[model samples]
Target: MSSTRQFSFEFFPTKTDAGHEKLMQTAAHLATYNPNYFSCTYGAGGSTRDRTIDTVKHLNDVIKVSTAPHLSCVGDTKADLRQLLTMYKNSGINRLVALRGDLPSGMGMASGELRYANELVEFVRKETDDHFTIAVAAYPEMHPQARNFEEDLRNFATKVKAGANIAITQYFFNADCYFYFVERVRKLGIEIPIVPGIMPITNYTRLARFSDACGAEMPRWVRKQLEAYGDDTKSIKAFGEQVISEMCERLLQGGAPGLHFYTLNQAEPSLAIWENLKLPR
Candidate 1:
């Protein structure tokens, strides 16, 4: 983490060889902009663990960009987690996006050795002794599974206290939610940088589905505008670019530490928003 505002992008491990090659090309394109780091996400229960490690290694060693790999507690034993940690450490990857991952369908709640993100954070610290710069997840609008906002905030505070160095929030359209969340976190004596996650709009149908799944609100006005556009992808993209660009402006101006984009393995959509912001290359 630099004193300067950080900017990063996230990608998921693609399944097929061609898809992985294409993803590497995408990462190479984004690398031109010199993001703070590029992160690769693993599948639930570490289903795509090997692919994640490969993508991260290629991004860091081949593409020559600093890379962080996402690690989750769900569907993994402590030994499983420890082995991955050792592999990452051996590979010279120093940053991590630690999470209490979503349980796969039909998986018992009693799945992983660690139950919560705070516990995972604590485990990482105890295992690594500061070898990694751990970034945890935050929910400005509150986690979908959280019982209430207060409980969610408390959970976040617990993670911070467990030795998370920073947080990346779930994407939200409402800048106000992010500001309000930060305001409250400060009240709880937590001051780590909570970078806002940005999701560029490309396909309305896909975006809507993701929003619903993640419990991120799509403001009525935005939803209506997108619906009106229907299958007009051009208009949808233009409107999306404008809306998200403006929101990013507000977040940065309001003193947000940085942005972490959910790029969905595409370079152009996130790049369109980045170019609009005129961020340093």
Candidate 2:
């Protein structure tokens, strides 16, 4: 609902006990920037439900930061999702990023009644009386499963009508993709805030594989810079900072609502980009 650009962050819950400390440290460090809200990603197929709840609740309770927990309906029953919603309400988290998460490896099929994110959005609406402001994933490049770009827009519209308050895209390297998608969706009259998802490319190989999996293209210029940095962490991070900072500038200038950084459990790139933006408090 804010006309000015705002910032939010995304993190995934860790698998080990030590990961808890690392995540807490990262959250505390980044909290000072006063992000609009921070999200903790739920693993595909409900893999980290407990951990996601724990991390999100901790941020709200201990860190006193607004938090959103990613919720996937890929393999959860209606009862299961109801319980999860109850947990979120009890933890004082009022925001959720509803997703029809990717299927588990080798499954090749959804294991739950809600096959799409809109269905999950409907479920959330039915469970709560607008207490939760739901966010859903949008694909600028077109979701791989969508029949076409138009279908993708229609799907996004359906989610908004089903009560999703925000839409955060999957990460992409092309700003044009985001701009064009926004134009098209605006024409559809949905009009909810569509925040761009930005992922700073720190590790070339790891980022490349993720982009491939998500249907986001990694441009040749980015690939060349990554290779040039080779094994040097400092150089790689500097390159990442420059790349993400510029991306954020372009998106804001082009009329994006805000930027969402997929921090990958680290604060350096996200923090650097925030400083570069110089957003007023």
lDDT of every predicted structure (CA atoms): 0.93, 0.88
Off by over 4 Å in 1: 1-3
Put down candidate 2 lDDT per residue, 1-281, tens digits, no spaces: 24476689899999988999999999898888788889999887988988998899888899888999999999999999999899889878899999999788886878887888889999999999798989999899999888888888998888888998889999888899999999998898979989999998678778888788788987899888888878897888888778878988999988889989999989987777877888754
For each candidate in turn, the TM-score is 0.98, 0.95
What root-mean-square deviation over C-alphas does model 1 reach?
1.1
Model 2: per-residue Cα lDDT at residue 51: 92
The superposed Cα distance between candidate 1 and the true structure at residue 169, in angstroms, equals 0.4
Index of the highest-lDDT prediction:
1
How far is 94's C-alpha from truth in model 1 (Å)? 0.2
Model 1 poorest 10 in a row by lDDT: 103-112
